[model samples]
Structure formats: structure tokens, C-alpha cells
Target chain A: MNGNGKKKRIGVFVCHCGVNIAGVVDVERVAKALEGYSGVSFSTHYIYMCSEPGQNMILETIREEKLDSIIVAACSPTLHEKTFQSVIELAGLNPYQVEIANIREQDSWVHSDKEKATLKAIKIVKSMVEKVLQNESLEPIRVGVTRRALVIGAGISGIQSALDIADHGYEVLLVEKNPSIGGHMIQLSETFPTLDCSQCIMTPKMVEASRHPNIRILTYHEVESISGYVGNFKVKIRKKPRFVDPDKCTMCADCEDVCPQIVSDEFNMGLSFRKAIYLPFPQAVPGTYTLDIENCLGLLPIRCGKCKEVCEPDAINYDDQETVFEEEVGAVVVSTGYDLYDLNHLGEFGGEKYEDVINGLEFERILSASGPTGGEVRRPSDGKVPKNVVFIQCCGSRDPENHNPYCSKICCMYTSKHAMLYKHHVPDGNATVFYIDVRTGGKNFEEFYQRTIDEDQVLYVRGKVSKVYKEGDKIIVWGVDTLTGRKIEMEADLVVLAMSMVQTDGVNELLKKLRISSDANGWLSEAHPKLRPVESLNAGFYLAGCAHGPKDIPETVSQASAAVAKVGDLFAQEQLLHEPTVVPVDEDLCSGCGICVTICPYSARELDKEKGVVKVNEVLCEGCGACAAACPSGAAQQRNQTDDQIFSMVRAILRG
Target chain B: MRIRNREKPFGIEKPVTARGQIVIIEDRCKGCGFCIEYCPNDVLRLSDKYNSKGYHPPYVAHEEECVDCGFCQMNCPDFAIFSVEVESGEREPAPAESVKR
Candidate 1:
């Protein structure tokens, strides 16, 4: 737009999108209508505005007609906003000077009436035309970045992220809540389809990560709090006391012999017991005994000094206390992984009451050679080999309103593996699986499931189990075969429930602390589901693994690597350029109400108590317009998003 | 559906013959009966009194028989009960027993 009351020189370019739009909307009529519109100097229609010739057409029109700004009526801006912006920027026009009127997704693709679609397309163009008249040139704000990265949760995803980022020459702090870095992957005996030993594949990575010069592995620790934005996050990690010093204590059995307290071995999924003073597992990362303070008679010397007195290295110190430390990082990758839905909630399955009924992970432990039963397929009720094992699929998944609505992506394959493993352990025995459907989407997964039924003799019943109960030494399962339309009942020695997956516990609180958005299903929400899957809606933070949704091992590793690539890209840049559309408070208009300071999710705004006004951290502000809407005095106005421009556009649309 | 009969996982035996004082934290009890079922001297039983969460917590039934094995304390899933050893002369009598004496 020009000054001194002269009409602005503007141009409009309408696209056919290869009949994706022209099939419904009359592109010729819409272009002709906008050509005659006020302030439009030139207007034309193109077969493909994003194509080479079509882009050249817009560039030629801008120079030939001496146009000030332009509008491209095409598909949704999310698809090609940057493409057209860079094109116009090359033609000596401000990137923000151009507006993309989404006639396809908003008009042509939605409306059926040709006459009405053309009319609506013209109106959409007119609104952008009016909005663009007041557009101002803006430059991206450049900010400094810290070189280090922080990875929360040392699961396979976190481990992979740490390894990838560290390999790329960036320092990483890998934090885990448990004393080990393996996560649930470590507890697993074998993986699906391939049947490769999980420990053999997992431990090498763990050892490599612990030894990585760029990676600092922090096990037995948790993120207490995290502040600051991406490129400079100040993290507070809480380190739980491991009473037994990891360095001095040579993992000997002396303390275990003297310790009298017996506690459930949680690492084995509570299937067996261990001494109060014992290692989490034989191959624990640090390989040190941690005194169970809750189960220990007391933490004082006066109470029970058995372990301390017997300790040859004198590593058992009762004075150990939790310590919180801080670190600085440029980016964060949250791959905390998922937790299995508890089987105890399903009363019909008798999962909690009946000792024979166990969960999938527990069965995994039983099949593991280092497990309590020494890898033998023995039922917990009685240490005997279970001849006929019953595996239930979709136990608490894919049943909306009653249980989890989403399918646990790994269950179908894992159940097939369980049955196959069972048949392998007991050559003479057979395994039966009750399922709604056998989903084998991964590579060789379908063949594996078929092999289980054909070679392994695992029976697959297309059904959902209604109830299960223990009678004598057998677990009776009542179900119906949907394919045969017949009700059936059977008795087996043990029953395994394939429970659903959920975002790990305390993740919601952690998301709130990080100011990261989560989906309705409570999984971490990504910036864009299809395009920006690895990035969080908030800047400098990324999502990976089952943190966003249920995913198998391969998918989790892929996502973790993708997140690492994103962090690497950010680190590759010596400085970052942030969006300059942030709102700045007009000190004269701001009453220092402090609403913007409290309402900002990113904590980008701060109230200046001395000046009785608020200030904005432009680098942190994402221009979400929260404070702009809340401003009573018309302060905190976003650049280029002033009230006058919006009124003009709304008025243009309302003008019949 | 209830099973016909049930049995405890295993029986515990006291290795020492020392007098002990039993301490019970009322609210922490979940009434799993791990302490009662595993107590070597049969020193505990489920009480008629219920905790705030509606589980019938166990109470010391035969305190004099406790031999400071700490089996009940170790077996307690909730850590609601424990026994501390006492010398013959160090034992403190209960209020009712002291009144009777």
C-alpha cells in the first residue's frame, strides 16, 4: 500500500492445482472477478502455482506490473506457505507481503456448488487482499544456542538419542529414574519375529553409552525440574541415594548373606524375592547393591547393622541422601517410553486374584534364562511346567468405554512370540491364543505368526475372552469364536494377559513442567502429526518413541534417530532465527496487570515491577497471541496483527 | 468363584528365642495378612477394627510368644508391622498386664 491516499499496487495468482481445485471451483471466473477488485493491479490464473513456470509467471507479473504485494490462491498454507514466501522474497518483495488464500481446502474441496464455490473463492481472495494491504516487512530474530543436549529417560529411545547426538559431536546428559539404563527393553528376554536375545543386542549399547566420551549416563536419577527454553535449558536432576557406594563396593555376595530383609524383586516384575541389600540385577549398569530403605529395619546403625558390619569395602553408608543438581542444554528429547496398563484392574480376567493369571512382561521373565524360574515355563502357583498355556490378546485394549481404546502396537506380535516360545520350551505342549484379529504389519511378522500356527502348532482362536478363573491347578477361560459363531470354554495351566500401553507415570506432570502439549489420549503431542512428527509444538523440545504413541522397537529407534537429526540440525547452526511475530507490550498502554506474565505457557513475559509494566523475551515468545487477546488496553499487540488490519479483512469478507 | 481350600506360601521358623516388642502402624496396613500368615509364633491375627481404607489390619495376639525373628516385618508388603528385640529385664509389660500384676 502507498501513502498520500494512493491505491496499493497488488496482484493475485489463482492456481488450478491440476484439477484438484478446478474440478469444483471455476478458477477462470474467480481470477477475473479479483482482477477488477479495488487495489489489484494485475491478476492471472495458473495450472500449478507451485510449479516452475507458474512461479516464473508470478515473478514476471510482479516486475512487469510493479506490484507491491501478491496473493497465491492455492491449497492450505501449511503445505506451501514457505515455498511461495521464499519465491516472493527472491523477487525483491517482503516474505510476509504475500498471503496464501486457501481456496482448495477452505472452498473448492469443501463446497459442491460451482457457482457458490467460485463466489466463496473470490471472497477468500478479497480477505487476503485486504489483510495484505497493511502487511509490514519483518526479519527473523537471530538468537544464540547452547551446544549441549539433554535426553530424559534412558530407555532404548533415550539411549539411541544419546548415542546419535553424541556421535554427531554434541554432549548429552542421559537421565534415567531406575538404577539401570536398559528400561523395559532390558527386562525383556527376546524380541519379536527375529527372536534375537534382547540382552545381547541391548547390553552392548548400554555399555557403549556408559563409555561414550560425549555422553554422561545418569542412572538412578530423575528430572526434578527443567527451566529455560531450547538452546539453553537449566535442568534440575534428583539423584536418589544408592546407599552402597558404586565405586568401592566390589559386587560381592557378603552383604546379601548378612542382610535379613526380604523384598520383592521389581526388576523381575515382582515374580520373585531378593535380599533388601542387593543389586537390581546381575548386569546392572553400575553393578552395586542398593539398600531398600523402605523394607530395611532402619537406616540407622543402632537398628540393623548387618550389611555394614559384613561389608568388606565398607561401602554401605546410612548417611546417603538425595541430591539435586543442575545442567545447561540447548535442546531436549523426551523418550520416556510407555507403561503397561495394570492387569489388576481387570476383575473378570481374575488377573490379580489368581496366581496362574499373569501379564505379558511377567511371562517374559519366566521365559528368560536368568529369571527366577531359570527360564523354565513354570506357573507361579506351583513350580510345575505348564503344558497348555492360554494367551489372551487385547485384554484391555481396543475396547473403548471399558478399557484402552488404542491397540498396543506390539501386543499382537509379542503374543505370537509368547506362544512360539512356549511351544519351543515345552516340545510336547501346545499354546492357544484368544484374539480379535492377528495383526502382523511389520517385516516377516505375518510369516512368523503363520509359522507359529503351522510349525509351532499354536492355535489361534478369532475371539475375545469373556472371563477367566482358577479351579484346582487349572485356569478356565470362557470365550466365543467369532469366526465359527460358537461359544467355547477351555482349561489351561496358566493364562497371560496382553494389556494395553499408556504414557509413563508422571509424564503429564513432566509435560506441564516442560510446557509441552499432549494429545487427548495423554500421549505427547507433536507439532505436526504427519510432517513434523519429531518436533514438539514448543520450540527446542522434541518427542520420540512411545512417548507420542504406542510403537514397536524399530519405530521407536527410528523416531529417536529422527529427533536426534533435528537436534543435530539445530546444533549445526551457530545461531537460530526465531519468528519475529512476537507481541511487545506498549509500556504507556500496559497497566502492569501481570495477566500476561502468569498466562504465558513459556514464561516469556515478565512484569517490570519498578516501571509498572511488562516486558517480553522475544526469543522465547512464539507469538501464540494469548496476551494480545487478554490485553484490556490494546497493549501487547503482535507485529503485523494489529486490530486495524483484522477489521479491514473482516469488513472485506462481510461486504456482500 | 472361590477355591475349595488355600494354604500359605510357606511356614516361617524363628532362629532365635529372644523376647520382642511388636509395633503396629495402624493406617499403613493394607490387610494383605502377609505378617499374620508368616508370623512364626502365630503372634498376629486380623483385628475386628478396620483402618480408614477399609482393610482389617492385624493386631498382636500372642506378643509374649514373639522371638524377634522379624519374619512378620519382612513379609509385610505394606511395612505396617515390625518387632524389636528386648532383654528379659528390658521388657515393658502392657497396661492391662501391669495392672493385673
Candidate 2:
């Protein structure tokens, strides 16, 4: 089916992959079995088909046998599909003409019997050969790249990724669903190990990012929808109303002074109160105030406009409405970060009922210099400095029966830090940390953890707290120290729980809008666990920071930088070349019933009203074959995964 | 179908023209001394004077021995200090008499 009217010559290469495949499956017999296949003009086995000599042998055989197509029966396509595809391309064949049969993971590794594994390998190879015979020589898809990137979340991760992309000389649109751009880092008193003041380092970067020429900060905005493919993506963002104009506001705090409505401040983790119309924090970037319309008296029915009356700049606009706009970007970096697991179900812990008991972040706010207690480390009940404090680790984490099965990675270290901070402020304070095991794997993290025990004289109890109840004025904690085998009773003034972390709110809706998938726990799924950590399965989309999983600041920053590097590499090319193995529409067979249009998750298929047929957007189709499977007329067929090609492969495999 | 960079591009390599000196913004330093601890070369030490935040900021203890590794800058969560490579002429020569010490 090439230019010449001659029978296509195809070669099948089977790789031993060392003991990986050769240990169980008979590779030699699998190659010999493919020799009788009609399209397989050449068949051979190599020790390592991905090595230099193995590739040379393939190149020599292809040239000698005049083969136009190749079938690589080897490991999973995720591992070697690109390798063999490039090898075929180097041998003057279209890359699409190279088909990969995943015999290692699908056949050999999964099956126990050698005879059956070899037979299954032969069938997979034969199926790939049939699929390759039907493959048309395809040109790489070339589409113009927008040369711009979108970064969601204004946390340290999003900020770092945006700064990296902007430094690479490309435009970046950083969107945050908050009033300010600091994310959760700004709420911390200090970073662990180094003990450097968090705001002293974070604020400058936030200021620099707001002033960056290539970076546009869109605070108080959420991504509404995402469309198009890798090289070019069309995104719609809904910018919520921020009554105070950022440009006109001077951050004078006059609006906050006059506003009578007091609400629980989210920045301080509800450890303090802020006026209904106020800035999130003193060092909030853009230095702008946002009106919490839900709680503000000035919004609903216009009850009180005292702040508007006192404002000299008249920055407050009561007529502000949510505005939606679109942006074209070449890539997207997701760093939406995480939220703490709610401890409402744990009645024994008293986290929900007790006023003195708080989570780690709430404790962080209580120790913050700008917090309500002014860094006093006081009990929330009576605003008095507590003499005794208890810090519990792995609350609702790593407990399969009660809570999340996975360890919230930061709890061990942060709980130690909280105890240390409490000891630092409350010099003579009795601080006890109850933990299952102390996990300190980061650089110098173990040293920081040890210092809390030896240097600070903090007590470490290897146990789980069974119950916490208020007995008179003191809170009594009951638990058994597993190491000492002693049932202990401790009465503490305050208790801090290191709660588990989960995906932030509204992330599921965002995932649906982006068409990206998540794991069983709702964490974003990476393309591969080790090979491709930052990239999602959907091309042009990247993940950074805790959005993927629980990670520390250093790990989050490194991953953010990696995500930007991917975006920069994609932006480096003016036109991106995608794999041409996408779906093609058959106008003659299409029923114009709009089934394919509805079935396509990528929005690639559309019903043409004029032609009475379903049209395919070649660039958008990812070749998932979902539309093909759902198509009643069999018109929505993938390029190489057609019904005839698939039927022949099935028949050939079953007959073998 | 093959195209390569035909002309020289700009800003490819950040010009290391600050002659390998660590600049400490005194006010920003929270006295964590991470720069001193993580510095590969023994170029920095805690200063005797306290900053506005009541923390001892770090200072260049051995300027001549510095190699501009930037470990101090990277490790400093406070963004209090950073290393910059400067032009050779812009840097002052160490005293010839004290060079032996």
C-alpha cells in the first residue's frame, strides 16, 4: 500500500530484554513462530532490542529486506514505544508504521506457563503485524504553539513554576482562586530545618512576581474550562468580584478599620478575626482588599456602606460582577496544592468539640508574629499561655480502619517542629509529642528532629492517644506508650493534631474541566510513577507541588521547576509535531447521529450540520478509540485500530 | 523540514559578572545562618551586630576564599543573601601583605 504496487515487506523484532522476558517466555520460539505470518518478511530475536548492536541489526535487516514496516515485540509501550518508533524513523520509515506489542508486561510477566506465554507473545506480535499492515504512512502533526503557559494556584509551587517560565522569556498567566498570591506558605511562622522566617523570604518573591513584565497575576479567578490540544489550548477563566480595585487601593487599612462586620479569618486558620472587607494578610501581594460578599453587610441589600463612605480613593465598587474571559496557552501547570483532612469523625480526639484543641495549621497561626495572640502561643479558650502542650502525629493518617491509609508525609516533621516552636516560646513549658514513628528523610531533617529531643528537652512518647476529655480545667489525654509498655495519663493545657492532607476543594470539578484523571484517593495521576512525574497523561498538562502528593518545600520547588522546564521545552518550538496516529472520520459511513461527538471526551468530534456527517478535529483526537467503540455504524475508527484490522488480529491469535 | 538556531540568542547564560561575591541584604536576614551552614566554602560567619528582627545576620568572613557557589542563596529561605559573579576589574584586590594569612 506504499507508493509502489508491491506486497509490503514487514519485519518483526523480538527482544529478550535480558532475564526480564527470557526468564519465563521463550523469545526464540516466539520469533520463529512469526516467520510464517504473511506480511512478516523478516523475523529475528535480539538480546536487547533497545541497544546499539540490536538497533544496528534491525536497521541492516530493514535495508536488506526492503521492509517498510516493523513490529517490536518487547516491553510495555510506555517503556520502548518511542525507542522503536525512532529506530524505524531513522531507517527511513514513517514512525507511525512501527507497531509495538507489549509482550513483557501483558504476556510474559503476567503468565506463568512458558508454552502459553510464548504462544501469547506470538499472537500479540501477529496482531501488531496486522495492525502495522493497515497503518497508512502518516506525517507528524504540526500545529502552531501559542508560546504561553498557564499556572494555576498562587502557592509556592505555582509561584516558582510561573517565575521559571517567565524567566525563560515566555509569557505566563498565574491564576489563583484567592484574594492574594501567597498560598499556604505565608501562613507559616518559619520553615523547618533552616528556621528562616517564611514571610521575610516569601514576600519579596511575591512582590517580584506581581511586577514581572512577562508574568500576569490573576488573583480571585478560577479556570472555567479548558479546550484544544497540546500545542494550543483555549482556557476560560472566571474572575470573581474583588470590590476594591487593586490599582487604586493603597493598602492603607482604613477600610478594615471602619468595617464593623467581623468574620473568621481564613489566612490565620480561624485563630483570629478580620473585618468582612479586609486584606487576607498584611503582606498580601497586589496590596488589595477583597469583600467577602457572603458575610459583608454592604453587599446584600446595601445595608452598611461605612467603608465606602470613608474611602478617599473610592476604590470600593459595589457594582463589581464576576467576569469571564478566555486565554490561549501552549501548556498548563497544575499546582492547586492541598487541604488538611477534616477530623470531624474523630470524636475521641475532641478536635471538633474542644476550643483549646487545634490542627497543625491553626497552631502555626497561633505562633505567627501577626496572629491574634501576637505570637504568644496561648490557649484559645481564655487567651492564656498554656503551661503544658501535647502534639499528636498521624491523626487520621496511616490508619486504614479509621482514616487515610497513606502517611501524610509532613506530619512527622511538622509535629516535631510544632513541639520545638512551642518549646522555643514557652521556655519552661512541658511539651510532649506522641508519635507512631519519627520519619525524617530529608537533608538535615533528622538533625532538626533530634534537636527537639536532646537540645530542647521535649518529651517523645511512642504511642497513640486513645481519648481526650476535659476534666475540670485541664484536658486529660489517655494512651499507652508502646515502647515502654506503660499506660500513661497526661493532663495538658492544649493539644495539637497533625491531620492528614487531601486534595483541595473544587479540584474534582477542575479535573473534569481539564479532562485529566485522578487516582482512587483523588490525587492527580502522573503519566508514570518514576519516568514522567511532572507530566499528566494528557499532553501539554503538567503537575507540580502537593497537587501530585504530599511533599516538603524543597521537593515542591524542584518539581515546580521541572514542570516549567517541560513548558519551556514545549514553548521552544514554534510549531509542535504530534504523533499522527489519531482518528480519521469516514464521511460515507457516518450516520450524523452525533453519537461520536458526545462520546469523545476530548471534544474532537462534531456533527457537521451542512454535510449531515460527523467531522473529526484531527489535532484534538487523542486516538483513545472510545468513540470507535461507541459508534454503532463503525464509522469512527482509529487510524491503525480499525475493525477489520482488529478482527483479523483476534482471529489470528485465537487460531494460533 | 529540519531547522536549527541560525542566529545567536540572548540571555541564554546569565552573565556571571559580580566577581563571585555574596551580597547580604542585612534587614532581610532572619539570622537562621543557613547560608553559613550550607556554604561549601568557609566564606560566611554570623555577625556580632543584631538586625531589626533581633537576629544575628551573616557576613562575608573570607571574601578572598569565596568561590561564588550560590549554595548560601539557594539554602536561605529568607532570601537574605545571594551570590553574584562580577567582572574581574570591578573587584578590589586583596591586601598583598595579608594574602599569606
Candidate 3:
């Protein structure tokens, strides 16, 4: 009860939601039914409860009715809970006294029978009225900040976020599951619209992050576990062992010369070979050589020690073990990047059988000056220059029954870039592109596509490729040209499949450890797609780059910088305020069985051995109600949502 | 809570063997061949028949000679094959077709 309570006065407001609710539910009937409710002193109905006049009506009623609490029967609380709360607070009343019953989404929109739906709306409103009478006006709790940030997946997005946060004078930890800091961006020859060299633009940023005073980079490391929330979080990282010691060895070629083990080079998209003890590339950040223990034959039981035997500095450690460590930070930015469409899933395109068929990234490697063929448009089957090359767009995209249904936004522009680059390499070669639709939705991108068609003399055919096979040192592509209404078959020297981008493997497990929810399509969920696009639903966590979905370089960088701005906003506050709805322990009812201690995910509840009871860390509790649900003796009860209040609410709803 | 105990079953027909066996889900194989390359006992080889994905899945050529060093299980990039250890004195060996589905 309130301080000077003489029978608490409550008001109930019903909304039509502009035919969204009134089309099915009778809002006038709902307000009339609640007019004589037990605690309700006033009842009214409005056309739009979220508009300016509707809010003014609520504010004036709170003053005239002397109401201590108000229940708004409107749409879902996720839309208008804060709006009504602010209206009451503006009228010199407590914000917690406003209860919103979601009648539109939960009752009216889902049902067709108007008679039953209006009764259901009345029941839902009555339950809210019962719950509001028992609520207490509580203040938010204030906690201190840790003033540090962690960025996962040292890709282009991660690098940008780390640089932005470090420039804001806060310490940052950058963790990557690769040997180098640069992501897939460094593997490309050039970007679209501007035709700028990818490595030339990426190398400077990698060097700057490595030399930054406030940034600490941990390559070949992955997040193992995460704890706490918002301003205070603890993270555990697992570091894979690199057999060569970084401090003792120089970036030299002596180790690679002596290593006998050979493996496909991932940096070149497996188009080339490298020794087991080689660097990812020459311009790799940190400029250190890493020995892959998985492919190296010298690690287990010491079968071969050729690299260690020839090392002048004795830097090789065959006894290296994987290490696990921890770090504490106030905020997190996820930028795990993406993977190319698996060639295993594209077997129809002969990506696995024929050597001439390649993906977009592999074509990038071939066009690079440092790539396998040294910037020559030679077919992978043999080192012969191709006379005609075919580009197939949307290989595994926009096919709902078999593959991803969404369009890979970058394919059309990148395919245009590929055709122009191939034309520049082989002047007499003909370039044909089979596309579903030419989607150029970025700045200057449509103009770039037109320039490529006019200057490069590239053939654009609107169609889909049905099958691709190898025949007599040439690749045969069978497709249908929708514009001409005819089936067409052609022979080409090389075939490049513009495959779709997919989420990186094993990132779902990391998200589960952090308790973040992913969408049905497997991308990370944003707080709100329009209002709060950079934030994760959880407080103090942020999303960036392709981790949210597929996007281009400029959009990914903008999101990364925006995520850093949110983290900077967090660090600006001296003490952060948290929800005061945490659970409290009842010493009289606790059995000291330690069940609540083991069930809380936040580690908020602990058993007191001396007192034979359980104690709660009020600030750490998030009011998830796990401890209350698992308690055997009813010791852990929520602040506002209690068993007595819930029983009364059930009675009120059941009365109808 | 009440605790319950059960009586052990007797007179079961089974082979008494100490060797381990490996099972393969043919459709899941991408034919990376990392398993066949890493097998310490030379127990596996690439199959001639193609799975639904048109990639050659591996088969156990020397099943009787498998020591189950687990090198293939640990090294398979596609996770298409796994090894099951046999207890010293129980259980019947499952047929290859029985495990494929």
C-alpha cells in the first residue's frame, strides 16, 4: 500500500488502436465493463492511446481522479509501456504504477469471434488491474562501471571498432581465431565502384591497430565463456598453441625452407601450397611466423623436428600446450564476419569435380598480383589463358526450396567488377554473366555497372544456369535466357560461381555462452531494426558487420563505428542505474539446500553456511526468476511479481 | 526422492571382442579425405559410389585390422565418421547398412 493510502485509486484506459483493435474488439464495451472494477476509480476509452491527445487525456485524468495507478488496455507493452509510464510520471505520479495489458496482439488480432474476444480483453485488463494494486514504487539501483571493452573476431569490423574505442581513450581487447588480424578483405584484389586495391587500403589499418597504445591484440584466440552483465562482465578466452615462439623468432624464411610438411594455403583460397611453418601472407599484421600444430608433423611424439633442428634462435617449442585465460570488460562488440558458400553444397555447378569452376573469392586470388598465377586469367585446369569466361550470379541464393532465400546484396556489383577485371587481363576474351536481376543498390554502383558494360563490352544475359559440366578441355554451361525465351548452351574456358555469403561456423555456440538470442535465419538479433540497430537485445552488448547480416564494406564500417559510440556512451556515466526489480531472499523460509545457488545463471544467489540460509547479491540479480522457480521452500520471491499477487491476478481473470 | 535399482540381464548372445569399430554417415561426407589421410591403421579408403551430394564418401576396407587409434575421428573435417569402442565381453557388431541411416 502507498504511504497515505485511503483505498488506492486506479484508472483503466482502453484504446481502439485505429481499427487494429476496434475492428475486432469492442473497446467501448471493455471500458464499460471495467467502470465498476474493485480498485478502479475511473474508466475511459480513446481512439489512439499512444497519440498526443490520448496522452493528455491520461495525464488530466490522473490529476482529477486522484488515481495512484493506471492500466492501459492497448497493443503489446513492448510498444507503449514506456509511453504510458512517461505520461504518468509527467503528472507527478510514479512510473511503476502504470500497467499495460496487451489486448491487441494477444487477444483481438489473434481471434475472430468478437463476442469471445471482448470477454478475453476484459479478463486481461482485470488481471493487470489486480497486479497494479500490489505494486510498490521502487527506485532504480546505481552501479559502477569497469571502463573497458572487448571486440571479438579481428576482422574489418572488429578492427574498426577497436580503433574507434581506443581513440576514445578506453582500453580494448581484440580477440581473433586466425593467425592474422586482417579478415576476408585482405584476400580481395579490388573493391567495387572505385576499383581501389583491397590490400593497400586494409594494410594501413592493420598496422595502426597493431601499433595502437590502448589496443591489445590476441590472435589465434577464441572466446570460451562469458559472465556478468552490462557495466561489469568477465570473459574466458581459449588460445590455440602456435609451436613457434613469437618473441624469440624473427620473421625469416629459414624455418619454411626446412619444414617438410606441405598444406593447402588458406590465404590463397586453397589455390596454392605453403609449408606448415609459413606466414599467412607477407603483409600479415604482427609480421610473425606461426607454426600450425594441426598440420605440422613435429608436434605429437616428435616424429619430425626438421624446423626445430635448423632454427638458429631455438624458437620452436614442441611442448607447447593450449592456454585458457580471462578478462573483464564493460562492453562487447561482435564482428565475427562471414564465410563463402560451401563448395560442398554447390556440387551441381561442378565446383567439386571440375577444376575450372571457382567461387568469387578464388577469382579474387587469381586476379591479385601476388596470387598463384600472378594476375593472369589462366584456367585452374591448366595454365592456359581462357578465351571466354562465364560468371553465374546467385548460385546458392534466392532459391527457397534448395538454398538461401535472400539475395546476396554484393553479387551483382562484384560480378560486374570481375568481368571488367577479366577483360583487362585477357583483351580478346569474351565475358558473359547469367543473372537473375541486376541489383545495384548502392551509391555510384549503378553507374559503375553501366560503365563496365559500355567500356568492357561484357555480355549481360538475364537467365539462370541449369547445369555446368566439363567437356574436352572446355566448360559447358546450359542456361535459359528469360529475355529471349530460349534455352542456350555455351562453351567457356573458365567458370566463376558468384556464391552467397553464410554465417561463420561455430559462432552459434559462442552466442549461446553469452546468452544472446539468434534469429530464425541464424543471424544475430538486433534490439530494434529501426530505432536501435547496433545493439544486441542484452544491455552493454553490440553487433557489427556481417554478424548481423550480409552487407558491403562502407555499411559494415559505419555499424562498427556506431557500436563504438554506444560503448562510449556507457563509459561516460559515473555510476550506471539498473532495474530495482531484483529478487530478495527470505531468511525465515530458506532451507539452505543450496538449490538456488546452483540454478542462478548470473551467480547472484549464494548459500550462507553460518546462518543456514541463502543471500542474494542485489546488484548482480537480473530478476530472471530462475531461483524463485527452483526454490523448494519459497525463499526467493521477486520484488513486484510474487505468489500472492499472481494468485489474486489468476482469481481476477477467472472471475469472468 | 526414492531411489530404484534394477537387476542385470543374463544370457545375452554377443561376441567377446576388444577391438573398436567406426561408423560412417555417407551423405554427410564432403570427401575432403582428411580421414583417410590421417588414419594410423590404414582402415579406410575412398568409395567408388557417390552419395547424394556427388562426393565420394570413405569406406572401411580393413575393418578387421582397425585398432581405433581415433586419428580419423579426430581429423575428419566434415564430421561424417566416428568410432565406437567395444567393451571386452559384450554387444553385437552392427552392420554397415544398419548405421548408414
The candidate that wins on TM-score is: 1
Clashing pairs in 1: A231-A330
Q: What Cα-based lDDT does every candidate model obtain? A: 0.83, 0.83, 0.84
Q: If both were scored by lDDT, which would come out higher, candidate 1 or candidate 2?
A: 1
Error of 3 at A53 (Å): 5.5
Q: What is the C-alpha lDDT profile of model 1 across A1-656, one tens digit per residue?
A: 54346567889999999988999999999899998687888888989999999999888888889987899999998899899988888899988888899999999889899999998898999999988887777898887899999999888999999999999999999998887788888889889889998888998998999889999988888898888877878899999988888888899978876554444567777666555677888888867788877666565423556688889999989899999999999999998998888776798997578877888888888899878788888887777899888999997789887988888889999999999999999999879999998889999999999999999999999998899987777788999999999998998898988888888889889889888989877899999889899999888899888889999899999999999999988999988888788999999899999998988867899999899999899988988889998888888888878777788888988883
lDDT of 2 by residue, A1-656 (tens): 44365677899999999988888889999889889687788999999999999999988898999999998888988788888888888999888888888889998788889888888888889878877777788788889989999999989999999999999999999999989998888889888988888898899889989989999999999999998889789999999999889999988877776554444567867555555688988888878999888666435422456678778899999999999999999899999999888767678987467777778888888888877677878876667789999988999888989788888899889988888999999899999999999999999999999999999999999999999999888999999999989998999999999988888888878887787889877789999899899999999999999989898898999999999888888888878876676777788988899988888888988989999998888888878888888888988778777898889788877877
- Residue A20 accuracy (lDDT) in model 1: 88
**lDDT for position A42 in model 2:** 91
lDDT of 3 at A63: 91
DockQ of 3: 0.02
TM value for model 1:
0.83
List the lowest-lDDT window of 10 residues for candidate 1 chain B: B1-10
Off by over 4 Å in 2: A1-4, A14-40, A73-78, A101-131, A650-656, B1-101
Query: lDDT-based ranking, best first?
Result: 3, 1, 2
Q: lDDT tens digits, residues B16-64, model 2?
A: 1124777999999898877887664468999899989888999898876
Listed in order, each prediction's TM-score against the native is 0.83, 0.82, 0.79
